[model samples]
Target: MKLIRGLQNLQRAGIDSASGCVLTIGNFDGVHRGHQALLTRAVELAERYGVPATVLSFEPTPREYFSGERAPARVSNLCTKLLDLGSFGIGQVVLHRFGSAFAQLEATVFVRDVLASQLGVRAIVIGDDFRFGARRAGDLEMLRREGARLGFEVDGIASVCAEGLRCSSTALRDALAVPDLTHCEALLGRPYRLVGRVRGGLRLGRTLGMPTANVNLRRQPALRLGVYAVEARALNSDGTGGEFLPGVANLGVRPTLGLTRCLLETHLIDHSEDLYGRLLEVRFRQFLRPEQRFDDLSALSAQMQRDKSDAAAFFASKSTGPA
Candidate 1:
């Protein structure tokens, strides 16, 4: 699948060349079940119309862009979302940069200039509640009217609901607070993942006889701080592929180390390698416990051993998929 970053990349690929593409536009943050439903419809439209299926999402999402500070914690970043989209068979993804200018465009102008003229969208797919453009005047009705005017089709799928609740990125965020992977998988159509580059650490884990690879995740608000049983993967140094390893991780300020910033430290079971500057993507399979200050190093070590045992057991009990 091709990744189109920003307008220049789109122009370079000749967006005007793809005259009959079916497009879906949204943040698509978690790519939750609702999103999956929407994308599935888009793919069907693409098949019916014999056009490329494309997703038009934004970087920094509209919420994050408008927020004076960083937006609330994200459920999934762009790379992970792209990977998930690939698995779902999306043909191409055009990442538009959402900002004041793009946000300020009137609904009609957005549909005419962006979706129709620029992207050549033969059809558009969105959730029933999706809104966009100039204080979000672009509703399903607006999209339908515009589709009629521009000779395009519109597909507005109802939000997917489960167990008397709506499936959404926001709802999934709340579920992740409980570190609930079962509910998360149900909503997300897969496990919740946190990904980032592995950076150098203070070696506190090594001092305690359990070394860890530090992963710097994208800053997210409402991130649960705790110890979790996880499945971890690192890109092979050769850049050829990834290696998955069962692991336990801690997400906190490391009160034991006198640290005050949230960080993820993971210990891969039965493997040791120097990974000072590599990307490590860890999927939280289950929440084992909350972060706590122990009385001393001995106590912490004992608890870590127990955590290791529990993580190993959890991995053993489940299929060794991408967590």
Candidate 2:
């Protein structure tokens, strides 16, 4: 997929920036089922207009930029979100950077300069809740009114829902907080998975006889801090395929060491190898126990062994889909 960095690239590439695409804009944080519906409509429109289908979303998301450290946990990082877009057959994305400067642009100027002149949008499909521009003044009415001037049309899709649950990034994050992986799969149309490159750890797990792959969670973890039943897999260089390993993962600060930083520490049940620098995918299956500081290393090690046993039992009782 082609990544449209910002307005400059969109301008330099001329009106063919995205081949005069039909587009939609949103954070699309998790590319959940609701997003899938929106993108599907965009694709259908693009095919009807004989132009490319494109997505315009923000980097650091508007929520991430404004909320800073207090920002909600991210269900899928940018890379994962892009992958989800590609899976839906979208080949271009307008990844606008949301910064102090960009946030100040007037509503019409943003549409005229970026959406119309730069990309030559054929149409814009957006959600009912979408808002944009300086102090968040933009809305669907503004888009349609400006569409008269810009020659593009606008369509708003009703949010998708399942089993009375509105499919949304917030709802997905909430499911993750409960660690209802099954519900996440329902909302997202897939299992909830965490993706990151494995990094070297303190080797303490090895000393405790449980070698672990440490993953740096790039944002506040959505799942509650706990021990969990998990299935860990390494992604190949081409970002496809890996050996599935039944495992247990701990997501929290290593409280025993007084480390305040949160981390994902996963130990494969029967496989041990150096995984530093490898891209790892961990699918959480069940919440095992809340994170806590033990009285001593002996206690902690013993608890880890039990966590492993629970993981094995969890796997035996349920398939990898979710617990």
Deviation in angstroms for 127 in model 2?
Answer: 1.2
Distance from true location, Cα of 157 in model 2, Å? 1.3
User: What are the models' TM-scores?
Assistant: 0.86, 0.89
Off by over 4 Å in 1: 17-20, 221-223, 235-244, 273-279, 294-299, 315-323
Q: Write the residue-wise lDDT of candidate 1 on 1-323 in tens digits.
A: 77888865777875674565899988887888898898899999999988889998888688978885756787765556777786677888998788888879999998988888888899999888989889888899989998998899998899788666899888888987877778888887667776666788788789888899997656643447888888787764322246678899998887876767778899998889776787677778879998999888899999999999988888888875433
Enumerate clash totals for all models, in the order shown.
1, 0
Q: Where is the poorest 10-residue window by lDDT in model 2?
A: 10-19
Instruction: Write candidate 2's Cα lDDT for 82-121 as tens digits.
Output: 7678778786887878899888999999899878877789
**Candidate 2 wrongly placed segments (more than 4 Å):** 11-18, 49-51, 319-323
Model 2: pairs clashing at backbone N, Cα or C within 3 Å: none
lDDT values for all models: 0.81, 0.84
lDDT of 1 at 62: 87
